[model samples]
Target: MPESELGGPEEKSYTAPGKVPLDSGWVDVPRLSLSASAGPGAFGGEERPFDNFRFSQRWLREQGLDGSHLSAITVEGDSMEPLLRAGDEVLVDHSPQPFRDGIHVVRLEDTLLVKRVAAQGGGRYSLLSQNLAYPPLEVNAQDIEIVGRVVWKSGRL
Candidate 1:
Protein backbone atom coordinates (compact mmCIF):
# COMPACT_ATOMS: atom_id res chain seq x y z
CA MET A 1 0.00 0.00 0.00
CA PRO A 2 1.27 3.49 -0.90
CA GLU A 3 1.98 6.05 1.90
CA SER A 4 -0.21 8.63 0.06
CA GLU A 5 -3.16 6.21 -0.10
CA LEU A 6 -2.85 5.33 3.63
CA GLY A 7 -3.00 8.00 6.36
CA GLY A 8 0.60 9.24 6.85
CA PRO A 9 2.34 10.72 9.96
CA GLU A 10 2.35 14.16 8.28
CA GLU A 11 -1.47 14.05 8.10
CA LYS A 12 -1.84 14.06 11.90
CA SER A 13 -4.86 15.83 13.33
CA TYR A 14 -3.96 18.61 15.76
CA THR A 15 -7.54 19.02 17.03
CA ALA A 16 -9.38 16.21 18.77
CA PRO A 17 -12.48 14.68 17.15
CA GLY A 18 -15.86 16.22 18.03
CA LYS A 19 -14.10 19.40 19.20
CA VAL A 20 -14.39 22.76 17.48
CA PRO A 21 -11.08 24.49 16.80
CA LEU A 22 -10.75 28.09 17.81
CA ASP A 23 -10.55 30.33 14.76
CA SER A 24 -8.65 33.61 14.70
CA GLY A 25 -11.20 35.01 12.25
CA TRP A 26 -13.75 35.09 15.06
CA VAL A 27 -14.09 37.27 18.17
CA ASP A 28 -15.49 36.24 21.53
CA VAL A 29 -18.34 38.38 22.79
CA PRO A 30 -19.18 38.05 26.48
CA ARG A 31 -22.48 36.38 27.32
CA LEU A 32 -23.84 38.20 30.32
CA SER A 33 -25.65 36.63 33.27
CA LEU A 34 -28.69 38.74 32.50
CA SER A 35 -31.78 37.50 30.72
CA ALA A 36 -33.89 39.87 28.62
CA SER A 37 -37.53 39.01 29.06
CA ALA A 38 -39.49 38.61 25.84
CA GLY A 39 -42.77 38.33 27.77
CA PRO A 40 -43.63 40.28 30.90
CA GLY A 41 -40.14 41.09 32.14
CA ALA A 42 -37.13 39.85 34.11
CA PHE A 43 -35.20 41.55 36.88
CA GLY A 44 -32.05 43.23 35.62
CA GLY A 45 -29.60 41.81 38.16
CA GLU A 46 -26.13 40.28 38.04
CA GLU A 47 -24.44 42.52 35.52
CA ARG A 48 -21.61 40.11 34.82
CA PRO A 49 -20.43 37.92 31.99
CA PHE A 50 -20.81 34.16 32.53
CA ASP A 51 -19.62 32.93 29.14
CA ASN A 52 -18.82 34.02 25.58
CA PHE A 53 -20.22 33.70 22.08
CA ARG A 54 -18.02 33.60 19.01
CA PHE A 55 -18.76 36.27 16.40
CA SER A 56 -17.24 37.16 13.05
CA GLN A 57 -15.03 40.27 13.26
CA ARG A 58 -15.59 41.12 9.60
CA TRP A 59 -19.35 40.92 10.00
CA LEU A 60 -19.21 43.26 13.01
CA ARG A 61 -17.26 45.82 11.00
CA GLU A 62 -19.68 45.46 8.10
CA GLN A 63 -22.55 46.26 10.47
CA GLY A 64 -20.61 49.26 11.79
CA LEU A 65 -20.65 47.74 15.24
CA ASP A 66 -17.91 47.70 17.87
CA GLY A 67 -17.24 44.36 19.56
CA SER A 68 -16.09 46.05 22.77
CA HIS A 69 -19.56 47.58 23.07
CA LEU A 70 -21.31 44.26 22.55
CA SER A 71 -22.72 41.68 24.97
CA ALA A 72 -24.93 38.60 24.78
CA ILE A 73 -28.05 37.82 26.80
CA THR A 74 -30.57 35.02 26.65
CA VAL A 75 -34.18 35.73 25.63
CA GLU A 76 -36.59 34.49 28.29
CA GLY A 77 -40.06 34.30 26.75
CA ASP A 78 -42.17 33.78 23.64
CA SER A 79 -43.53 37.32 23.45
CA MET A 80 -41.15 38.04 20.61
CA GLU A 81 -41.73 34.68 18.97
CA PRO A 82 -41.34 34.08 15.23
CA LEU A 83 -38.54 36.61 15.43
CA LEU A 84 -36.86 35.82 18.76
CA ARG A 85 -37.95 32.80 20.69
CA ALA A 86 -37.39 31.64 24.28
CA GLY A 87 -33.83 30.60 25.26
CA ASP A 88 -32.32 32.33 22.23
CA GLU A 89 -29.00 34.09 22.75
CA VAL A 90 -29.12 37.63 21.39
CA LEU A 91 -26.16 39.91 20.72
CA VAL A 92 -26.77 43.40 22.09
CA ASP A 93 -24.76 46.38 20.96
CA HIS A 94 -24.18 48.79 23.86
CA SER A 95 -22.83 51.39 21.47
CA PRO A 96 -24.68 54.67 21.16
CA GLN A 97 -27.14 54.60 18.26
CA PRO A 98 -29.91 56.81 16.91
CA PHE A 99 -33.01 55.72 18.76
CA ARG A 100 -34.97 54.50 15.76
CA ASP A 101 -37.44 51.70 15.19
CA GLY A 102 -35.83 48.29 15.82
CA ILE A 103 -35.50 45.46 18.29
CA HIS A 104 -33.80 46.69 21.45
CA VAL A 105 -32.99 45.69 24.99
CA VAL A 106 -34.47 48.19 27.44
CA ARG A 107 -34.57 48.63 31.17
CA LEU A 108 -38.14 49.36 32.18
CA GLU A 109 -38.18 50.21 35.88
CA ASP A 110 -36.46 47.24 37.55
CA THR A 111 -36.99 44.80 34.70
CA LEU A 112 -35.06 44.07 31.56
CA LEU A 113 -36.89 43.30 28.32
CA VAL A 114 -36.29 42.67 24.63
CA LYS A 115 -38.87 44.27 22.36
CA ARG A 116 -39.36 46.30 19.22
CA VAL A 117 -39.00 49.98 20.07
CA ALA A 118 -40.84 52.61 18.08
CA ALA A 119 -40.45 56.35 18.29
CA GLN A 120 -43.69 57.96 19.40
CA GLY A 121 -42.49 61.54 19.01
CA GLY A 122 -41.90 64.02 21.86
CA GLY A 123 -39.34 61.79 23.62
CA ARG A 124 -41.78 58.95 24.12
CA TYR A 125 -41.47 55.37 22.79
CA SER A 126 -43.59 52.28 22.53
CA LEU A 127 -42.33 48.76 23.21
CA LEU A 128 -44.07 46.41 20.81
CA SER A 129 -44.08 42.64 20.81
CA GLN A 130 -44.10 40.22 17.87
CA ASN A 131 -46.79 38.13 19.55
CA LEU A 132 -50.16 39.79 19.20
CA ALA A 133 -51.25 38.40 22.54
CA TYR A 134 -49.02 40.88 24.31
CA PRO A 135 -50.00 44.53 24.17
CA PRO A 136 -47.57 47.34 23.42
CA LEU A 137 -46.09 49.26 26.33
CA GLU A 138 -45.94 53.01 25.92
CA VAL A 139 -43.08 54.54 27.89
CA ASN A 140 -41.63 57.97 28.44
CA ALA A 141 -37.97 58.85 28.04
CA GLN A 142 -37.56 59.17 31.80
CA ASP A 143 -39.27 55.87 32.58
CA ILE A 144 -37.09 53.65 30.44
CA GLU A 145 -33.38 53.20 29.73
CA ILE A 146 -32.07 51.77 26.47
CA VAL A 147 -29.52 49.15 27.43
CA GLY A 148 -28.56 48.44 23.83
CA ARG A 149 -29.78 47.37 20.41
CA VAL A 150 -30.13 43.72 19.48
CA VAL A 151 -27.82 43.18 16.51
CA TRP A 152 -27.80 39.39 16.22
CA LYS A 153 -29.38 36.18 17.51
CA SER A 154 -28.29 32.52 17.63
CA GLY A 155 -31.04 29.92 17.88
CA ARG A 156 -32.38 26.72 16.44
CA LEU A 157 -34.33 26.70 13.20
Candidate 2:
Protein backbone atom coordinates (compact mmCIF):
# COMPACT_ATOMS: atom_id res chain seq x y z
CA MET A 1 0.00 0.00 0.00
CA PRO A 2 1.10 3.57 -0.63
CA GLU A 3 2.03 5.72 2.35
CA SER A 4 -1.31 7.54 2.15
CA GLU A 5 -3.20 4.25 2.41
CA LEU A 6 -1.32 3.02 5.44
CA GLY A 7 -2.23 3.89 9.00
CA GLY A 8 0.18 4.25 11.92
CA PRO A 9 3.44 2.33 12.36
CA GLU A 10 1.67 -0.46 14.17
CA GLU A 11 1.56 -3.73 12.25
CA LYS A 12 -1.90 -4.86 11.21
CA SER A 13 -2.93 -8.24 12.54
CA TYR A 14 -5.60 -10.10 10.64
CA THR A 15 -8.25 -12.38 12.03
CA ALA A 16 -10.12 -13.52 8.91
CA PRO A 17 -10.56 -12.45 5.33
CA GLY A 18 -12.56 -9.22 4.92
CA LYS A 19 -13.04 -8.87 8.64
CA VAL A 20 -11.64 -6.15 10.86
CA PRO A 21 -8.76 -7.21 13.05
CA LEU A 22 -9.83 -8.11 16.56
CA ASP A 23 -7.27 -5.84 18.22
CA SER A 24 -5.86 -3.44 15.69
CA GLY A 25 -6.06 -0.56 18.17
CA TRP A 26 -7.16 1.63 15.28
CA VAL A 27 -10.41 2.07 13.44
CA ASP A 28 -11.19 3.12 9.89
CA VAL A 29 -13.68 5.97 9.69
CA PRO A 30 -15.45 6.32 6.37
CA ARG A 31 -14.92 9.41 4.26
CA LEU A 32 -18.06 10.50 2.49
CA SER A 33 -17.96 11.50 -1.18
CA LEU A 34 -19.85 14.72 -0.54
CA SER A 35 -18.17 17.93 0.53
CA ALA A 36 -19.25 20.67 2.90
CA SER A 37 -18.55 24.03 1.30
CA ALA A 38 -17.01 26.78 3.35
CA GLY A 39 -18.06 29.49 0.91
CA PRO A 40 -20.75 29.04 -1.68
CA GLY A 41 -22.91 26.03 -1.05
CA ALA A 42 -22.22 22.61 -2.53
CA PHE A 43 -24.91 20.26 -3.70
CA GLY A 44 -26.21 18.13 -0.88
CA GLY A 45 -26.18 14.74 -2.54
CA GLU A 46 -26.80 11.22 -1.40
CA GLU A 47 -24.48 9.71 1.13
CA ARG A 48 -21.68 7.78 -0.52
CA PRO A 49 -18.58 6.65 1.33
CA PHE A 50 -15.54 6.83 -0.93
CA ASP A 51 -12.62 6.34 1.44
CA ASN A 52 -11.55 5.62 5.00
CA PHE A 53 -9.44 7.55 7.47
CA ARG A 54 -7.61 5.61 10.17
CA PHE A 55 -7.59 6.90 13.72
CA SER A 56 -6.51 5.44 17.01
CA GLN A 57 -9.49 3.98 18.82
CA ARG A 58 -8.07 4.97 22.18
CA TRP A 59 -7.64 8.56 21.12
CA LEU A 60 -11.25 8.69 19.97
CA ARG A 61 -12.44 7.29 23.29
CA GLU A 62 -10.26 9.77 25.14
CA GLN A 63 -12.03 12.55 23.30
CA GLY A 64 -15.41 11.12 24.29
CA LEU A 65 -16.20 10.33 20.69
CA ASP A 66 -17.77 7.22 19.37
CA GLY A 67 -15.96 5.98 16.28
CA SER A 68 -19.12 4.42 14.93
CA HIS A 69 -20.78 7.84 14.88
CA LEU A 70 -17.96 9.52 12.97
CA SER A 71 -17.46 10.26 9.30
CA ALA A 72 -15.02 12.37 7.33
CA ILE A 73 -15.58 14.87 4.53
CA THR A 74 -13.52 17.41 2.62
CA VAL A 75 -13.90 21.16 2.77
CA GLU A 76 -14.55 22.77 -0.61
CA GLY A 77 -14.25 26.52 -0.26
CA ASP A 78 -12.29 29.41 1.30
CA SER A 79 -15.05 31.12 3.21
CA MET A 80 -13.90 29.38 6.35
CA GLU A 81 -10.26 30.31 5.84
CA PRO A 82 -7.84 31.10 8.67
CA LEU A 83 -9.53 28.28 10.52
CA LEU A 84 -10.84 25.75 8.00
CA ARG A 85 -9.19 26.10 4.61
CA ALA A 86 -10.09 24.55 1.34
CA GLY A 87 -9.11 20.89 0.94
CA ASP A 88 -9.10 20.36 4.66
CA GLU A 89 -10.66 17.19 5.96
CA VAL A 90 -13.16 17.37 8.79
CA LEU A 91 -14.52 14.70 11.07
CA VAL A 92 -18.26 14.91 11.68
CA ASP A 93 -19.96 13.51 14.74
CA HIS A 94 -23.45 12.48 13.69
CA SER A 95 -24.85 12.49 17.18
CA PRO A 96 -28.43 13.61 17.62
CA GLN A 97 -28.48 16.62 19.88
CA PRO A 98 -29.47 20.24 20.17
CA PHE A 99 -27.35 22.71 18.25
CA ARG A 100 -24.87 24.84 20.09
CA ASP A 101 -22.59 27.70 19.09
CA GLY A 102 -19.91 26.02 17.00
CA ILE A 103 -18.79 24.97 13.55
CA HIS A 104 -21.22 22.56 12.02
CA VAL A 105 -22.17 21.01 8.71
CA VAL A 106 -25.62 22.25 7.74
CA ARG A 107 -27.93 21.87 4.82
CA LEU A 108 -29.85 24.87 3.56
CA GLU A 109 -32.35 24.02 0.86
CA ASP A 110 -30.46 21.87 -1.65
CA THR A 111 -26.98 23.00 -0.69
CA LEU A 112 -24.60 21.86 2.00
CA LEU A 113 -22.46 24.27 3.93
CA VAL A 114 -19.87 24.33 6.70
CA LYS A 115 -20.08 27.42 8.85
CA ARG A 116 -19.98 28.77 12.35
CA VAL A 117 -23.52 28.41 13.63
CA ALA A 118 -24.68 30.67 16.39
CA ALA A 119 -28.10 30.84 17.93
CA GLN A 120 -29.81 34.12 17.14
CA GLY A 121 -32.79 33.68 19.44
CA GLY A 122 -36.44 33.12 18.49
CA GLY A 123 -35.74 30.06 16.34
CA ARG A 124 -33.13 31.84 14.28
CA TYR A 125 -29.49 31.13 13.55
CA SER A 126 -26.59 33.02 12.05
CA LEU A 127 -24.22 31.23 9.73
CA LEU A 128 -21.01 33.18 9.96
CA SER A 129 -18.01 32.72 7.74
CA GLN A 130 -14.49 33.08 9.01
CA ASN A 131 -13.61 35.22 6.00
CA LEU A 132 -15.24 38.58 6.29
CA ALA A 133 -15.53 38.93 2.53
CA TYR A 134 -18.70 36.89 2.67
CA PRO A 135 -21.70 38.21 4.52
CA PRO A 136 -23.19 36.20 7.34
CA LEU A 137 -26.47 34.50 6.59
CA GLU A 138 -29.34 34.76 9.01
CA VAL A 139 -31.78 31.91 8.78
CA ASN A 140 -34.67 30.40 10.61
CA ALA A 141 -34.00 27.17 12.43
CA GLN A 142 -36.67 25.32 10.50
CA ASP A 143 -35.09 26.13 7.14
CA ILE A 144 -31.77 24.53 7.97
CA GLU A 145 -30.97 20.90 8.52
CA ILE A 146 -28.11 20.08 10.79
CA VAL A 147 -26.01 17.33 9.29
CA GLY A 148 -23.52 17.03 12.10
CA ARG A 149 -21.09 18.86 14.32
CA VAL A 150 -17.49 19.22 13.22
CA VAL A 151 -15.56 17.53 15.96
CA TRP A 152 -12.11 17.71 14.36
CA LYS A 153 -10.31 19.05 11.32
CA SER A 154 -7.02 18.25 9.55
CA GLY A 155 -5.13 20.33 7.03
CA ARG A 156 -1.65 20.82 5.63
CA LEU A 157 0.51 23.57 6.98
Candidate 3:
Protein backbone atom coordinates (compact mmCIF):
# COMPACT_ATOMS: atom_id res chain seq x y z
CA MET A 1 0.00 0.00 0.00
CA PRO A 2 1.13 3.58 -0.68
CA GLU A 3 2.41 5.41 2.49
CA SER A 4 -0.18 8.18 2.04
CA GLU A 5 -3.05 5.74 1.63
CA LEU A 6 -1.78 3.66 4.57
CA GLY A 7 -2.30 6.70 6.84
CA GLY A 8 -5.86 5.75 7.84
CA PRO A 9 -7.64 7.10 4.73
CA GLU A 10 -5.42 10.20 4.96
CA GLU A 11 -7.72 11.96 7.48
CA LYS A 12 -7.99 10.22 10.81
CA SER A 13 -5.06 10.12 13.26
CA TYR A 14 -6.20 6.84 14.74
CA THR A 15 -2.79 5.95 16.07
CA ALA A 16 -1.13 8.05 18.79
CA PRO A 17 -3.26 11.14 18.25
CA GLY A 18 -2.03 14.57 19.29
CA LYS A 19 -4.07 17.44 20.70
CA VAL A 20 -3.81 21.16 20.02
CA PRO A 21 -5.99 24.05 21.22
CA LEU A 22 -6.59 27.75 20.62
CA ASP A 23 -6.06 30.70 22.98
CA SER A 24 -7.39 34.21 22.28
CA GLY A 25 -6.86 37.41 24.20
CA TRP A 26 -8.11 40.97 23.68
CA VAL A 27 -5.89 43.99 24.02
CA ASP A 28 -5.84 47.40 22.40
CA VAL A 29 -8.46 48.18 19.77
CA PRO A 30 -10.71 45.22 20.40
CA ARG A 31 -13.43 44.92 17.79
CA LEU A 32 -13.31 41.15 17.77
CA SER A 33 -16.39 38.92 17.60
CA LEU A 34 -16.87 35.23 18.47
CA SER A 35 -19.55 33.99 16.12
CA ALA A 36 -20.75 30.39 15.59
CA SER A 37 -22.99 28.58 13.09
CA ALA A 38 -24.46 25.07 12.78
CA GLY A 39 -26.53 22.97 10.41
CA PRO A 40 -30.09 21.73 11.07
CA GLY A 41 -29.50 18.01 10.65
CA ALA A 42 -26.88 15.54 11.87
CA PHE A 43 -24.92 14.06 8.98
CA GLY A 44 -22.45 12.09 11.07
CA GLY A 45 -21.15 11.92 14.62
CA GLU A 46 -19.23 15.16 14.20
CA GLU A 47 -20.32 18.14 16.26
CA ARG A 48 -20.84 21.62 14.90
CA PRO A 49 -17.98 24.07 15.35
CA PHE A 50 -18.46 26.83 17.88
CA ASP A 51 -17.54 30.46 17.39
CA ASN A 52 -14.27 31.83 18.76
CA PHE A 53 -14.57 32.18 22.50
CA ARG A 54 -11.67 34.59 22.51
CA PHE A 55 -8.97 35.53 20.04
CA SER A 56 -5.48 34.09 20.47
CA GLN A 57 -3.91 35.69 23.51
CA ARG A 58 -0.57 34.80 22.01
CA TRP A 59 -1.44 36.57 18.76
CA LEU A 60 -2.58 39.62 20.68
CA ARG A 61 0.45 39.46 22.94
CA GLU A 62 3.00 39.06 20.15
CA GLN A 63 1.28 41.93 18.38
CA GLY A 64 1.40 43.94 21.64
CA LEU A 65 -2.36 44.51 21.83
CA ASP A 66 -2.65 43.50 25.50
CA GLY A 67 -0.84 46.69 26.45
CA SER A 68 -2.85 49.71 27.63
CA HIS A 69 -2.98 50.98 24.06
CA LEU A 70 -5.68 48.49 22.96
CA SER A 71 -8.86 46.84 24.20
CA ALA A 72 -12.04 45.11 22.93
CA ILE A 73 -15.44 44.36 24.45
CA THR A 74 -18.89 43.23 23.43
CA VAL A 75 -21.25 46.13 22.66
CA GLU A 76 -24.29 46.93 24.74
CA GLY A 77 -27.17 49.47 24.53
CA ASP A 78 -29.44 50.51 21.66
CA SER A 79 -27.97 53.92 20.94
CA MET A 80 -26.11 52.67 17.86
CA GLU A 81 -28.87 50.32 16.76
CA PRO A 82 -29.61 51.29 13.18
CA LEU A 83 -25.98 51.20 12.06
CA LEU A 84 -24.60 48.89 14.76
CA ARG A 85 -27.22 46.48 15.97
CA ALA A 86 -26.99 45.37 19.59
CA GLY A 87 -25.51 41.98 18.67
CA ASP A 88 -23.44 43.02 15.69
CA GLU A 89 -19.65 42.91 16.23
CA VAL A 90 -17.22 45.84 16.11
CA LEU A 91 -13.44 46.23 16.16
CA VAL A 92 -11.85 49.13 18.09
CA ASP A 93 -8.61 50.88 17.12
CA HIS A 94 -6.99 52.37 20.26
CA SER A 95 -3.78 53.74 18.85
CA PRO A 96 -5.06 57.31 19.50
CA GLN A 97 -5.16 58.89 16.07
CA PRO A 98 -7.61 61.02 14.16
CA PHE A 99 -10.55 59.08 12.75
CA ARG A 100 -12.69 60.28 9.89
CA ASP A 101 -16.23 61.19 11.12
CA GLY A 102 -17.87 57.86 12.03
CA ILE A 103 -18.71 55.45 14.85
CA HIS A 104 -16.52 54.34 17.76
CA VAL A 105 -16.55 52.24 20.89
CA VAL A 106 -16.29 54.77 23.69
CA ARG A 107 -15.60 54.03 27.33
CA LEU A 108 -16.76 56.45 29.97
CA GLU A 109 -16.60 56.44 33.75
CA ASP A 110 -18.18 53.09 34.52
CA THR A 111 -19.78 52.41 31.20
CA LEU A 112 -18.67 51.14 27.80
CA LEU A 113 -20.70 52.43 24.91
CA VAL A 114 -20.68 52.02 21.14
CA LYS A 115 -21.79 55.26 19.58
CA ARG A 116 -21.34 57.39 16.49
CA VAL A 117 -18.53 59.86 17.17
CA ALA A 118 -18.17 63.09 15.30
CA ALA A 119 -14.65 64.26 16.03
CA GLN A 120 -14.37 67.64 17.74
CA GLY A 121 -10.67 67.90 18.76
CA GLY A 122 -8.25 68.12 21.70
CA GLY A 123 -9.86 65.07 23.32
CA ARG A 124 -13.36 66.33 22.67
CA TYR A 125 -16.02 65.02 20.31
CA SER A 126 -19.75 64.79 19.60
CA LEU A 127 -21.68 61.59 20.20
CA LEU A 128 -24.67 61.13 17.92
CA SER A 129 -27.39 58.52 18.25
CA GLN A 130 -29.20 57.03 15.33
CA ASN A 131 -32.32 56.84 17.44
CA LEU A 132 -33.72 60.34 17.69
CA ALA A 133 -35.29 59.59 21.07
CA TYR A 134 -31.81 59.79 22.49
CA PRO A 135 -30.21 63.16 21.98
CA PRO A 136 -26.64 63.65 20.77
CA LEU A 137 -23.96 64.50 23.32
CA GLU A 138 -20.96 66.77 23.35
CA VAL A 139 -18.12 65.27 25.38
CA ASN A 140 -14.92 66.80 26.70
CA ALA A 141 -11.46 65.25 26.67
CA GLN A 142 -11.67 64.23 30.30
CA ASP A 143 -15.27 63.06 30.28
CA ILE A 144 -14.59 59.83 28.36
CA GLU A 145 -11.97 57.57 26.85
CA ILE A 146 -11.65 56.41 23.26
CA VAL A 147 -11.05 52.67 23.58
CA GLY A 148 -10.75 52.42 19.82
CA ARG A 149 -12.26 53.59 16.57
CA VAL A 150 -14.78 51.25 14.96
CA VAL A 151 -12.83 49.57 12.18
CA TRP A 152 -15.43 47.03 11.08
CA LYS A 153 -19.00 45.86 11.67
CA SER A 154 -20.47 42.39 10.98
CA GLY A 155 -23.78 40.58 11.56
CA ARG A 156 -26.12 37.79 10.44
CA LEU A 157 -26.84 37.87 6.71
State the C-alpha lDDT per candidate: 0.88, 0.88, 0.53
Evaluated with TM-score, which candidate comes out highest? 2
Clashing pairs in 1: none
Q: Model 3 reaches what TM-score against the true structure?
A: 0.52
Ten contiguous residues with the weakest lDDT in model 3? 35-44
Q: How many residue pairs clash in each candidate?
A: 0, 0, 19
Error (Å) of candidate 3 at residue 116 is 1.1
Rank list by lDDT: 2, 1, 3
**Model 1, runs deviating above 4 Å:** 1-23
Model 2, position 33: C-alpha lDDT score: 88
lDDT of 2 by residue, 1-157 (tens): 3222355344452244433563668888999988899998999776898878888999999988889899999999999999999999999999877678999999999999999999989999999999999999999999999889999999899
TM-score of 1: 0.83
